[model samples]
Target chain A: MPAYVVGHKIPDSDSICSAIALSYLKNAIGEECVPARLGELSPETLFILDKFGFEQPELKLSYAGESLYIVDHSDRVQGPDDIDDATILGIIDHHKLGDITTSTPLECWIRPVGCTNTIIKMMYDFHGVEIPANIAGAMMCAILSDTVIFKSPTCTTADIKCVEALAEIAGIEDPQALGMEMFKVKSAVEGTPIRDLVLRDFKDFDMSGNKVGIGQLEVIDLAIFDEMKDDLHADLAALKEEGGRHSVMLLLTDIMKEGSEILVVSDDDDLTAKAYGKATTEGRVWIDGIMSRKKQVVPPLQDSFAG
Target chain B: MPAYVVGHKIPDSDSICSAIALSYLKNAIGEECVPARLGELSPETLFILDKFGFEQPELKLSYAGESLYIVDHSDRVQGPDDIDDATILGIIDHHKLGDITTSTPLECWIRPVGCTNTIIKMMYDFHGVEIPANIAGAMMCAILSDTVIFKSPTCTTADIKCVEALAEIAGIEDPQALGMEMFKVKSAVEGTPIRDLVLRDFKDFDMSGNKVGIGQLEVIDLAIFDEMKDDLHADLAALKEEGGRHSVMLLLTDIMKEGSEILVVSDDDDLTAKAYGKATTEGRVWIDGIMSRKKQVVPPLQDSFAG
Candidate 1:
C-alpha cells in the first residue's frame, strides 16, 4: 500500500492543506504518498481546495496496516483512530508532542513554527522540489489562517519568509485580500447549531485527570457573542455534562483586537481563576494580546492544572 | 527546590560541559539551576574541568525532589534513576527520543546537531548572554571532543561556527593544537583495566525489549585493539552473560580515518548479521563512515530488532 499522509481529526485549513502539499511533495520525490483526512473537511478548507483547483483527498477513519506520515498535529488524542496501530514512517508537525512512541527511529520534522506547512516548505527547499502552484496556493492559505495573517504570536520570521515566497509562487498579489476572503468563508457560521459552532474548532486535552475542551471562533465583532451568549452557555454546560469534562472554555476572538474574550463553563469554578490568574466576570474574562492557543492558552492552563 | 541539569548516565566531555554551561546560563537569567551528573567522570572530562579551573558538579543517582532540565539525553534508560517520579521541566538534547512522556506540556529542544553544546551556544547567542572564559573554554573543548576536531561525519556547519566563536572567546589561537593536547589526555587508556577501558564511552539501549550495550573507543591507531583483543573479548563475554544482555558490540574507532572496526560478542549469531545486513569476518566488521551512535548505529539496529 502507498504511504498515506494525514493530519489530526477536526481538520482545519492548515491540517488539510499541509497533508495535501506534503503528500504531493513526497510523491514528487519518487515516494508513494497519498493525502488523506481523518474527518470531514471544514467549509474554509473546501473553499481553499476549490480556489486552488484541486480535488479533495480521500477521507479515512483508520489507516491500519498502511505506512503513514502524519502532519499538523502530534498528540495521539488528536490523531486518526488507527494512530496507535499504524506504522508511522515519519511525522511533520508544529506542536507539543503527545504520547507517541515509535518502535524504530523515523524522521520527525517538528518545529515551533506557526504552521506545519512552513516546515514542509523548508523540506521542499532542502530537497530542491518545486511545489506546484495549486499546492503553493493551498499552503499559503493555511499559513494565513493559522498565523492570523502574521498577527499571531506564533508567527516567526521563518513563517514570514515562507509566506512571502509562497504567495509569489501562487500569484497572490495581495495577502490581505485573500485573507479577508478566507475569513469570510471561515466565519459564515451564523446559522450553525450552537453545539456544532462550539465544536467547529474545538480540541480536547487531558490535564492530570481532568478532561478539558477549548473552542475558538474568529469574528468581526463581539456583537455576535452577545447575540448567542445564553445558547452557547447552555450548549457548553450540556456538552461538559455529556462528555464528563471537568471544564469547557470558549474563546470569542475578535480578529481586529488580537485578543480573546473567554467564556468558561466548568464543573470546578476555581479552575479558571487558577488558570488565568484572575476571577472571571459572570463567566467571561478578557485576555488581551493573546492569539495562538498553543503558545498562550495551553501552557498556562496546563501549569495551573498541574499545580 | 532549584532545577538540576544533567546528561546521560555515561557522561562524556560534551555532556559534562553542556550541563555546566546551561546551568550557568539559566542561573544568570535568574532561574535557580545547578549542574549535576549521573555517572562517574571520565578522565578526559576531569582533564578539561581541571584545565578550566572548575570543580566537578555533584554526582547524583537521582534528583527525585527537584524538577529536571535534561541537557544531553531524554531516553528513560539513560535518564536519572528516579526519572519516573521526578517531574521534568524541560529537555535540551540531540538524540532520537526514547519512551519518555510528560503529564503536562514542557519545553523540549531537540535538534539534529553534532553536540548539545552547539545547541546551547545558539541559545546563548539568542539570549545575548556573554560567556565567561572558563565556561567558554569548557564548551569549546566539548565541541572539539564530540566532533573529533571537525573530522567526524556528525560535524555540521553549525558545529563549525560554534567552534570558531567559542575558540575566540576561550582565547585559543589554534583549535587543532589544543585538540591534540586534549586527545592525548583523552586517549590515555593504556594503564586502566580492560573492563574500564572498554566501557569508557558506553551506552545501554532497549529495542523492543532486547537489551544492548554499545561502547566506542576513539584511538589514534588500531594497535591498541591488537594488544587487548583477547582480554577485551573475555570481559565482554563475562559482562554479557552476567547482565543477561542479548548482545554487546564494541567499536574500535580510528579518529583519523573516521571509521570503526566493530567487534561483536553475541548470544544470538544472526543478530549482528541482521542489524548490519552483512556477515562479520571472524567476529569483526569495519564500517567505513560511521561516527554517531545515536544517529548512525541505533536507528538501523532498532529497525532490525523491531522487524
Candidate 2:
C-alpha cells in the first residue's frame, strides 16, 4: 500500500514543503509516498512556491475518512475522535503533544526545529539525496518563513545547519537576497482588498475564555498605516462582530517606525483599556512599542484574562 | 549613529526572527541596534510569535525613506535607486547577491544557508548568550518554518545543526510535534471570509509572460473541501479580477485523499486547460498525483505559458 504524507492545518510553507520534500525523499527510498496538504496555502506561501517552481500540494480538507502518514499535526490520544486511524504509521512534527497514543506502534520523528521542511531536508542529507534548485528554494523559503529568517526564539541549531547545506545546493550566496526578492514581489499591495489586507495573516485563538482573532498587516510606508487606520478600526469592529469574540486585536506595526500601533476592539472597555494601558471611550485602545504581542502583550493579557 | 537591522518584505519567519535575534545579539555586544521588520507578519507568523513569548518586530513596509542595515535583502549595484543605500552598515542574508555596493562598506555575513536566523542563532551560541525558553521556542519555530521542517531542498547542514542545538535548549524532544501544533492552531479555518482565506498565504509571480497568483489550502477533511469548492472557485475568479493576474490558481488538497482538485480561473481557457491536462468545463481543472507543484505542475505550466 502506498503511504500518504499529511501536514497539519493552515498549511504554511513548512507544512507544504515538508510534505513535498518528504515525498521526494520517500520516493528516493523506494517508498511510494504521496505529499498531502491539509489546508489552504496562504499568499505568502504561494510566493515561495512560485519562486522555487514547486507545485502546491494537493489539498485535503477532510481527514475524517482516510489513512494518512501524519506530518506536522496530531490530536490528543484521549481527545475527541479527531483522527480515526487505527494505526498511525509515522508521525513527524515539532510542537508540544498533549495526550497522544498510537495503538499500533509508530515510527515517529518529532524534532523541536522551526519547520518540518528542515527535517525532510535532513533525512535527504542523511541519506545522501540530491535536491533540485527549485526544491532548495522552496525549502529555503519555508525555513525563512517559519524561522522569521531565524529571528523567532523557536529556532534551533539543527535548523541552521540544514539551511547552510541547502543554501549551497541552491547556489544562493545570500539567502537574505533571495528572501528579500520574494518579499518585494509581495510588496505590490495595490489592488488588494482592505479586508484581505487586514486579514492577510490573521489567526484565531481561544484566549481567556474569549475567542480572539488577531490580524497583522505589513506595509512599506508608515503613512499608509495612518491612511488605513480608520478603515482598520472599522474592520476590527466588524471582525469583532463577525468573530463573536470578547475582543479582536489588530496590530498595525510600522516596521520602519520600530513600534506598533495596536488597535483593540471589544465590548469590555476595561479589558481593552487595561490591555492597552489606557481606556478608550470608543472601546478602542492603541498602544506603542508593542510589536511582540506574544511576548509583550499576550502574557499580560493572559494574566488579565485570568484576573 | 544607531545601526538599523533591515529585513526583507513579506518577511517570513526567518526574516523577522533573524532581525530580532540579530538585534538581541547586537544589543548584547553593546551596539546600538534595533530590530526592524521589513514587511508584514503572516497569520502563521503571528501564531508562532504567540506560541513563543516574543513580540512582532516593528513593521517596516518600505525601504524608500528609511536607513537600512540590509538584512536578508540587497540590491545590485545598478538595479535601481531603491536598491542603493548610503547607510548600509551590514548585511546578513542567505541568498546570492548580484553586484551589491555598500556606501560605508560595512560588515557582511552572507551565507548560503537555509535561513539568516540560523546565522544569528550561531552568533548567540558562540557568544554564550543564554536564550530564554520562549526565545528558544521562537527560534526553533522560525527554523522549522523556514526549512519546511527540514524537508525543503534548500536545507543545509548548518540549518539542521542550528535546529538541533536550539531544540535542546527549547526543551523540545520533537520539533515536528511543535510544528504540527503550531500548524493546527493556525488551521482552525472557521468563519474565515473566502477572500481572506485565499489571500492569507497567496503569492504573486510573473510566470512565463503572464502574472499569476497561486494559493494553497490544506485541510484535514476532504468534506470541507467539497463544501468550500464553489466558494473557492468564486474566490479564485475574484482573485484574478482583483489582483489583475492573467491566472489565479487555488489548490484544494485533501491529504487523506492523497490527491488534489485544482481550480484554475483565467480569461484564456486554453491556458488553464493545457496546464491541468484538461479542463473540467467549469472553469476548473483536476490533476491527480499533483503534490509538488514545483516538481510537477509549474514546469508544464511554464512551458505552456511559453508556448
Candidate 3:
C-alpha cells in the first residue's frame, strides 16, 4: 500500500501545502505517497490552493495501521486521534520537539524555521528534484502566511531564502501584494461563526496533563475583532467546557501592527496573565510583538502550566 | 561559550567519532562547536581514534545552563544528568524517535541507518564542507564497527555507500580488514574487571517508568565468553542493585555467528523470556540473528513493558 503524507488537524496553509509538496517530492524519488489532510482547510488555505491552481487534498481522518509521513506538527495531540496505532515512516516539521516516540527508526526533517514548506523546499533541493510551478506558488504563499510576510520572529534566514527561491520558481513578481490579498480573505470574519473564527487555526496542547487550546486569527487590523470580543469569549468558554480543557485562548493578531490582543477563558484565573507577565483587563490583554504561536505563545504557556 | 557536541554515556566508536566529525563540520560552517564526551572511551573507540591520529575529547559531566548539540543518541536517560537544565541546540541521531522534547525549535538529522557517522557525512555534504583524512578514517571505522562490517541487520545501503566514499577519502583499500582489526581490540575481556566489562557499551532506557540497563559485547567467537557468563550475570545483578534499575541485561554477541546470548538479571522473573518469546535457561537465552539492541531488542522490551 502507498504511504499517506498528512498534516495536523484544523489545517492551515503551511500544513496543507507542505503535505502536498512533500508527497510530490517523495513520488519523484520513486516512493508512492498520497497527500492527505486530517480536517477541513481554512479560507486562507483554500485561497492559496485556488490561487495556485491546485485541488484540495483528500480528507483522511482515521490512520490506524497505515504508513504515514507527518508534516507541519509533531505533537500527538495535534495529530490524528489514532496516530499511535499508525506507523510513522517519517516526519517533516518546523516546530518544537514533541512527545512522540517510535519503536523503530524513522526519517525526520525537523528544523527551527517559520514553515514546514521551507524544509520541504530544502528536501527538494537535496534530492535534486525540480518542484512544479503550481506547488512552488502554494509553498511560497504558505511561507508568507506562516511568517506574516517575513515579520514573525520565527522567520529565519533559511525561511526567507527558501521563500525567495520559491517565489522565483513561481514567477511571483510581488509576494507582499499576494500576501496582502490572502490576509484580506483571512480577515473576513463578519459572516463567519464565532466558533469557526476561533477554531480556524486552533490547536490543543497537553501541558503537564492540562489540556490548553489556543487559536490564532491574523488580519491586517485588529479592529475587525472589536465588536466580537464578547461573543468570541463566550464561544471560547463553551469550547473549553465541551472539550474538558483547562483553558482556551484566542489571539486576534494584527499583522500590520505586529501585536496580538489575547482573549483567555481559563479554569485558573490569570493563567495567560501569569504566563506572559502581563495583567489582564476583563479577560483580555494586548501584547506587542507576539506573532508566532509555536515560537512565543506555546512555549511560555507550557512552561507556566508545568511550573 | 562554544556549544558542546557530545554523545551518550559509555562512549562507543560511532558516538565518539560522530561527535568529533559533526563538531568539525559545525565549525567549518562558522559556528563555534567543541567535541566532548560524557564518559571514558572504550578500547575499540580508543583503537579507532589512535589509528586515525586523533585525540580523545574532553570529558564533560554537567550540562546545566550550557548550549549542547547532542550526537548518536536522543534518549534523556542516555544524556547528561543535567540535560534538562541545558539549552539543547540540536540533535543528530540514528535511533528511534525518542522522548526528548524541546521548548524551542532545533535542527535534527535522524535517519534509519546503521551509524551516526553516516548522517554526519551527509551533513558535511549538505554544508559543502570537506572532511579531513583523519576524521574520515575515524568515521569509516565507526560505521564499520556499528554495522559489524555491513553484517548487522541495521546496516543500510546509505551506510555501505558512505563507508565506500569515506574509505576512498581515508586511503583505505580494505575496510573489512580494518573492521576485523577493530573487533579484535573490542574483544579483549580477560584483563578487564567484571564491572568494567559489563559497562563498556552499556545504556539505560526508561520504558514506561521502568529503568532498564542493557549492555552488549561483540566478539568474533562466542567461546571467548563461555567461561565468563556466570561472572557477567553476577556483575549485572550488582549493577542493577547499585543503580536501582528494574533490570540489567547484557548481550554477548558473536559477530561471526550472527547471534547473541542474552544474560538477564531482572526484578521480575522471565521478563526477557516473555519479551523475546524465548525460554530462558539459567537466566540466559541465545537468539540467532540478533545483533542490534536498538533495532531488535529494545523495541520488543519497550512494547512488553508498555503492554
**Rank by DockQ (best first):** 3, 1, 2
Instruction: Please identify model 1 stretches exceeding 4 Å from their true place.
Output: A1-7, A13-72, A76-96, A101-199, A202-307
DockQ of candidate 2, scored on C-alphas against the true complex (2 decimals): 0.01
Please identify which of the two predictions, 2 or 3, would achieve the higher TM-score against the true structure: 3
Question: Which stretch of 10 consecutive residues in model 3 chain A shows the poorest summed lDDT?
Answer: A272-281
| Candidate 2 per-residue C-alpha lDDT over A1-307 given as tens digits, one digit per residue, 9 for 90 to 100 | 6667776555666777878877887888897887877556667778887767877777655545444566654433212244643335565665423224332224445455766777677567656788887788788877766665665445678777778778998888888666556555444456667777666656554454577767655333456555666777888889889868778877665434445566778767687566557665454454655554434555466556655
For residues B73-97, could you state the per-residue lDDT of candidate 2 as single tens digits? 4433212236433345566665533
For model 3 chain B, the run of ten residues with the poorest summed lDDT: B270-279
Q: What is the interface RMSD of candidate 1, in Å?
A: 4.3
Clashes in candidate 1: how many? 0
Cα lDDT of model 3 by residue, B1-307, tens digit: 8999999999898889988999999999988999999999999999998998889999999989899999999899899998887889888999998888888889999999999999999999989999999999999999999999999999999999999999999999999999999999999888898889999999999988999999999999989787888888999989999999999989999999999999999988878777998977888999999999989999899889978
- Model 1 Cα displacement at A94 (Å)? 6.7
TM-score of chain A of 3: 0.99
**Model number with the top lDDT:** 3
Interface RMSD of each candidate, angstroms, one decimal: 4.3, 21.6, 0.9
TM-score of 1: 0.68
lDDT of 1 by residue, B99-128 (tens): 666643355665667788988897787568
Clashing pairs in 1: none
